[model samples]
Target: MASTHPEHLSGSTADYSVAVPKSMFPGLFVLGMVSWTLVEYLIHRFLFHMKPPSDSHYLIMLHFVMHGQHHKAPFDGSRLVFPPVPASLVIAFFYVFLRLILPEAVAGIVFAGGLLGYVFYDMTHYYLHFGSPHKGSYLYNMKAHHVKHHFEYQKSGFGISTKLWDYFFHTLIPEESHPKMQ
Candidate 1:
């Protein structure tokens, strides 16, 4: 039988991280998660979708590596989660950027929070498609929204884990098309 996996995704499996302590040690991790969610939304809507000059095929490839692969292979279950090494690299890069602008401790905390948020966003996205979120749950709705982006409309519904930004920015899908459960 032919495999139903998404062909564009990297074939390497993600090495998931171990659980951090739930106490203060993990607080930065949690903060990272939340901060990353908003960052994810912003990056998805603006940077990921940006149409660059046609002359620079390299730029196009970068975009594809960052996001186009996911759009092309939306149903690819394995591609949903960000691999740990790349994710850590991205976090470190952003942490340094934040450090330059804000106080060291504040930047450190915010960056940590953002990374934690990213983890949750990645897992939630993967779960939306692969895991079973019961009908009428928030996650179920998010799954529907994301599926819509893949199948019906790619121009909108970029928010996967949360619609707050989509709603705020007027990118949300119309209700008439994807109706909510009663």
Candidate 2:
């Protein structure tokens, strides 16, 4: 399903499209969002945090910009919502990379879906720290998990919208540290 929240459809601020589509089929868009979330979670927990070999200062710097800074300043609102220019360039790069390996139509659809997912994650992460979720909902739980990543343990709980990826990868923190949904 497409996100019911308006924030997921925009970027940077409420006044702009940023890197998103003006309108999209909700089902396809939601699917894209979820699939991309997994990809995003994986990339953040692994590739972006990779310990590059010696003589790879450029890669380490790139990682710092792409993700490390977020860990360093998790509550910074401006940093929370992805800046559109850099996000668009990254998305385009992914499109081209996938295009070389998949059929055109499939690649286009998946890329579109993944882009929508990234949009949702950026917006949701912003809200989790700034706007707040309902008192007792999955979003509420997710917000707590994210805050833990920032305040207590930076190494796990990488999932944003859901923890399925963390669970699957055995990167979930201890239950005592995570707490039950409020």
Candidate 3:
């Protein structure tokens, strides 16, 4: 397994602190986690999956850098998680953005939640590819849905942790009709 450490994410000289009521942090964390699902869905559907023009080499390269590589090699373990270097940048951006738009305590809580959400999403994504789940189990179904996105429905089934957003956005992949095995 490849290390997901954000060794390159260090060296930031900024010092920041936010004070939040200890009692509220848990709820705020949960909210942050929940918010991450929507964020993940949006980024995946709109940004990562964006179709670059066939004639634009730069756009193609950008697409591959952002996500095309994963589609091309879905089982590459090292590439499965967001490399900490880039991920830290995005995480910082979100933290700063949240702090600017909301109260510091609220922002911190939500940011933490969102961060946890990203961790879960990455881990679950890896598991879906590499872990074997029992048939008819939740992970099994999730794995099936994800595999379909990779192999069959590239334009749909963008949801990984949950399919709620796909249903909400009407991007859910339609079930295929198959002859029952004898």
Most accurate candidate by lDDT: 3
Write the residue-wise lDDT of candidate 1 on 59-121 in tens digits. Answer: 999888877888888778766777778877877789789877765555666776776577678
TM-score of each: 0.72, 0.70, 0.82
| lDDT of each candidate versus the true structure | 0.76, 0.75, 0.89
Q: Which candidate comes out best when scored by TM-score?
A: 3
Candidate 3 overall Cα lDDT vs. reference? 0.89
Better of 1 and 3 by TM-score: 3
lDDT of 2 by residue, 66-88 (tens): 77788788767767766888778
**Of models 2 and 3, which has the larger lDDT?**
3
Runs off by more than 4 Å, candidate 3: 1-24, 177-182
Higher TM-score: candidate 1 or 2? Answer: 1
Candidate 2 segments exceeding 4 Å error: 1-31, 52-63, 177-182
Model 3: how far is 85 from its true place, Å? 0.7
